[model samples]
Target: MTLTIRPAVPGDEAEILRLVQALADYEREPDAVKATAESLSATLFGEPARVWAHLAELDGKAVGLALWFLTYSTWTGKPTLYLEDLFVAESARGSGAGLALFRALAEAARGLGCGRIDWAVLDWNEKAKGFYSHIGAKPTTGWEAWRLEGEALDAL
Candidate 1:
């Protein structure tokens, strides 16, 4: 099967949401996803879209997704592509879809003159870590992932 990666367009919300939920499940956060097709459409296709996504298809069948957003990096003095999620369907695990998605992201970064690409992998996902290493991606050694969401975010 031939695999292709392309930027998601307005009508892809359903497929994108499907891949996102699958990703949440893979990350052991099955119940954490609250995005609906409408929400995804608003975020990904609404005016001044804050996030972006790419879909990976094999012979016209959607099989993976790479969701990301841009962030400024003071150190690099340029925008950075922050990958929010990367997932390939269980049946397509070893079909190169993941790498194709990543390659597409890299191409996008290069085109946008982004300083770098960044993502976090769960510590327990050794397979993902290995794939990242194989792709020449090194984990950041000095920072811990932190979050201040929900009530804490609202309080602040």
Candidate 2:
């Protein structure tokens, strides 16, 4: 199967939102997805805080997407590409759509002189871990990811 990857346009917001929800479902955290098409469109296509997205198409239908934003790396003293979410519809897996999306993100990082590309994979998702390893990506062994949520998150 042939897949094409391209930057998302304003018209693609609905499909992107669908893919994002699909990803949340796959992670068994459907409620964690608080985004609606309208909200996504506003943030992604709006000014001042635009988030970039890459879509993967197979036979002209979007089957996957990657949502990312730029971040600064104090250690490298340069920007990094942080993939906030990546999703490939179940029907489209094993057809290289995921890899195509990742390649596009990597190319974007390189073109922008990004210091690194980083993303998180759930600890229980062995398939994703294997795919990442096959692509020469390794988890930072000594570091733990932390987050603050709810009221504490709001205060900060």
Candidate 3:
């Protein structure tokens, strides 16, 4: 079970989108995925690209994905790596692919001079939360996630 994690390149958009859709399904929001391969390609492989991703493979078969972007931290006076998504196919859950992907992401954050890494996990996902705890990640307290989009954004 050879596990490998590497930065995604052009032409990997289809695989990326597939993994993203799989993630959405796992999150019980199967219809919430609005991304397409074209969009992923444009955003991730275009000139002046900002979003990035890492693909994890087990024995040469794609099994996981880690997508992220850099955000500026006013307090830290440095960049922070915000992980947009991390998903491992159910069959690959215990194959160390998830941890390997995180290791790669952490290595990237350090190489890019990021002050920290941040991500959100669903409140109902005990398995994910436990895994995060095992990784020494502490949940942010005293704050809740907020979002505004679609009609609300247009009204604003």
Using lDDT, give the best candidate's number.
3
C-alpha lDDT of all candidate models, in order: 0.94, 0.90, 0.95
Per-residue lDDT tens digits for candidate 1, residues 1-156, read 888889999999989999999988888899999999999998898998989999999999899999999999999999999999999999998999999999999999999889999999999999999999999999999899999999999999
- Candidate 3: segments with Cα more than 4 A from true spot: none
lDDT of 3 by residue, 1-156 (tens): 888899999989999999999999999999999999999998999998979999999888889999999998999999999999999999999999989999999899999999999999999999999999999999999989999999999999
Which residue runs of candidate 1 sit more than 4 Å off their true CA positions?
A: none
What's the alpha carbon RMSD for model 3? 0.7
Candidate 2 lands at a TM-score of 0.94
lDDT of residue 47 for candidate 3: 90
What's the lDDT for candidate 3? 0.95
Cα deviation at 99, candidate 2, in Å, is 1.2
> Which runs in model 2 stand beyond 4 Å of their true positions?
none
lDDT of 1: 0.94
lDDT of 2 by residue, 24-126 (tens): 8999998888888888888888886568999999989999999999998999998999999988899999999989888999999999889999999899999
